[model samples]
Target: MTKSGNVLQKINNNYDELSERYNFTILPRSTRWNSVNRLGFSSTYLIRQGRVIEAIEVAELYTEYQPKSWQAYESLAKAFEANEDNLQALKNVKIAVRLVDNEVNKSLLLAYINQGDRVNMQLRSVKSLTLICLMLFLMVLTACNNDSKLDFDAFVEKKLTDFLIEENAQVASIAIVNDKLNYQKQFGEFPDGTKPHHDTVYEIASITKTYTGLLLAKAVVDKKVQLDEDIRVYLQDGDYQNLQHLGKPITLRHLATHRSGLPQDFAYTSADIKSGKAFELFSNYSEAKFFEDLAQYQLTSMPGETFQYSNVGANLTGYILENVYNQPLSTLVAQLITEQSGEEHTRFRLEPSEISKITRGVDRNGKIAPLLSPHSFAEGGLTSTAASIADYMQYLLSTQAEEVLLSRTLLTETSSEHGHAFFWNTYEYHSANPMFYHSGGSIGTSTWLALYPKQKLGIFIATNVSANNTQGKLNDIANAIVEKYEQVGQSK
Candidate 1:
């Protein structure tokens, strides 16, 4: 057998393992293939040993396990042909041909099926062998094309270098697969010309929203907050009495999903947010001021009327969560996310040693931006190392500790058409697998994190300089990684 076939055989060798141990495993027993996952291997093995009845039974089980799998249908067709069930064999082979993705593969299988003389089928088996060889050749060529087009490590290095020249960014990024750190790289350096290590930290601006969303999901599971219930109960009555519009109160769901009908930001003007004073302004921006703004402000539409991106709404959600848990948002976040995800260096506030590892953010003009003050502790305020973020992402994609990770509950779609899940966005297309993503930007930094859970893939990119078009750049990098990930994973 060839290397790829050997890999598939090894996967079949470990077929009886439980689902939770699926990290980095070649073939995760997908939901549809759960019942007779390795039966294809067993059926082929048994058919060669002249165990026709046993092979037929196993092949039938394989078909039931994944009715849509063209391979399973084709295997069953072969088993039927071995058993002299020519009519059943023809029916199954036709179905297999119909279900195939590639036209070439389908045509080859159809030609193999049209050879009706079972007496000379062994001679025709040479055609089947040739078809397999051609199919494998095509797959190799396709994989090579995808690799050249979507070399993720190369793309990140190139993009980071471009940012260094164009945006003057000091950037670091990493990719994780199957709970292991696969790529760790950096470009440029701190203004003082210090090289960044794997432990170097960066501000993950609105990317903090996904962490906040995870907290909300955990709160629901803990019965600390009801997802669909109004958040007014957690807020002081006087502070939220006028928050409603036409008697419609915003729920916790509305706030997390950006449908809370709140404004995008506070009154922090450019003048107030001077280089070093931004943190002071954010910290001193009082609860009283927040309520006063809400009291005076008018809602143009009712809560949940539409999707409006709102930093205020997310921060308020964090604040209410603090109230409900009777703990600081920082502490709650540490316990709920950072600790659970095994991200030792990720937190809302960094200690002095942790601070030493962080790169200083440079403004677009190349001036060192003001270091974030302690008050910017929620919403867009998060500092984390690339390695830790990669580990956290792997933790999210892994099946282990799923109840605490809350991947399933968090991914329940609020808008299937739009593919919004909590604060994460999902990409839905016929040919593409689903992915969950979120991006963040602060004055001097930007970050994007995403997961293709089905493929057990995750990527994180962060830069010290906030570029003019960071989002577009992040999207391109992410798409490239996803394409590469799917190609490699599918081949395995």
Candidate 2:
């Protein structure tokens, strides 16, 4: 019997071995020619079945069924490939890959295409090489399973993608490091399906805070700034004179931890936006303007009183850092994120200007929008690619990077729960998990970046669909992926 047919025979025989949901494996079992998730079983199915007309049906579903269920789509692509519609097949496959999250399945999908070395080679009948290669990839996934553990690489892919799909969201990329003797994989988009490439950029809304927060962590360790020092002391400018008289001081600790009594976002005064962009929040940015902003606004609660998640407070963090470093916040981020992390594609400076390259925040209907305004650079100015952000998180997992950016004592403080930071917020410290996390958003943008330092797991998820609050969606996906990876580690 052909290897493809044999491999299918074996998987069908032992389908019970696949992990379901949290266990990380999702190998569907079935009987007869119409095996369930058979499209996922092997690439051989495609060489024998790919055709064109059916592929169009899948594209139409992008608008109809939303972004889920890739099997119908992959089959359509397979039909196209079988019928010699290679270009059409490639195009259809892009959408299919986007719809899928299962790592094992996506890898199986790529088996036939990896034959790009001789795409021009013609075959009169079904080539035997295809069957051999296709079966091997399947066996590889099956082999990675030991006792009951799922493949680490596949687990990351499936969990994250499943989470995003669950959120009615999609991630452009999920960067991972699953060393071989295991799977090492990457999934998702760039400007043009490119590689070593820029496809993973998504509008990581609040994750912007994590980048700035890391810089603050570094600064506190450097002794250039103290957590307890009044931010007003750092800023000699009269623009912050209102802060000088707030009855209580707003310290760096309060700003970083978000315990300072600040609003979540700027609920600007009529004078500031009466005739201007009412929601164009960052249009009036200047040190003096900030003081005016502070003086004109009333403190809803006492400073440093309780935990409130104030974007205003976070932005103030950016301001304090910039003021102390004597540099622009974005520039500092360049040194902190890109230079330090050895990342090349990540940037906050938009093309020729300053545009976030990840997913640009989305509008009401999940259309791309802009994150144009923030009063200060530190609070919300960084825009990063998933790969770069993931790399940065991996850096935090390092004792080497930690020693540079922080002292053990300050790192403890940054991760500590100090009651409240700002607007109605409570910090949940995950000390046991040793997670470095932050969520961010700006109008139509949202993002989540987290790292389990001890576990050596880092996940950065960004979606282009903004104003949709992709934070929960991003985390759900990250958690799913992390769960799979941790399972693999524990199984070891």
Q: lDDT of all the models against the reference?
A: 0.66, 0.52
Best by TM-score: 1
| Decoy 1 TM-score against native | 0.63
RMSD, every candidate, angstroms: 12.3, 17.3
Off by over 4 Å in 1: 1-156, 179-181, 237-239, 269-280, 350-357, 400-417, 429-432, 488-491
Model 2 has an lDDT value of 0.52
Residue-level lDDT of model 2, residues 1-492, one tens digit each, is 222334444445655542221111323343332342443333332243442343343233222222234665665556556567555555566556444545556565655445543122232346535534544554574455543445555566676556445544434455543211112244443334444233444445555666666677778766778778878777655545445335677777777666677766564555754465655656555656665666566666666666666667777777778878898877877665555454545556545444433444445565555555333355565556655665565445543664333422222233355222211122343456545566666655556666544555556555544544456666676777667666666323
Runs in model 2 lying further than 4 Å from the true structure: 1-171, 177-199, 239-241, 244-247, 267-288, 350-358, 373-376, 402-431, 467-469, 490-492
What's each prediction's TM-score?
Answer: 0.63, 0.58
User: Can you give the lDDT of residue 56 in candidate 1?
Assistant: 76
Q: Distance (Å) between predicted and true CA of 445, model 2?
A: 3.8
lDDT of 1 at 445: 74
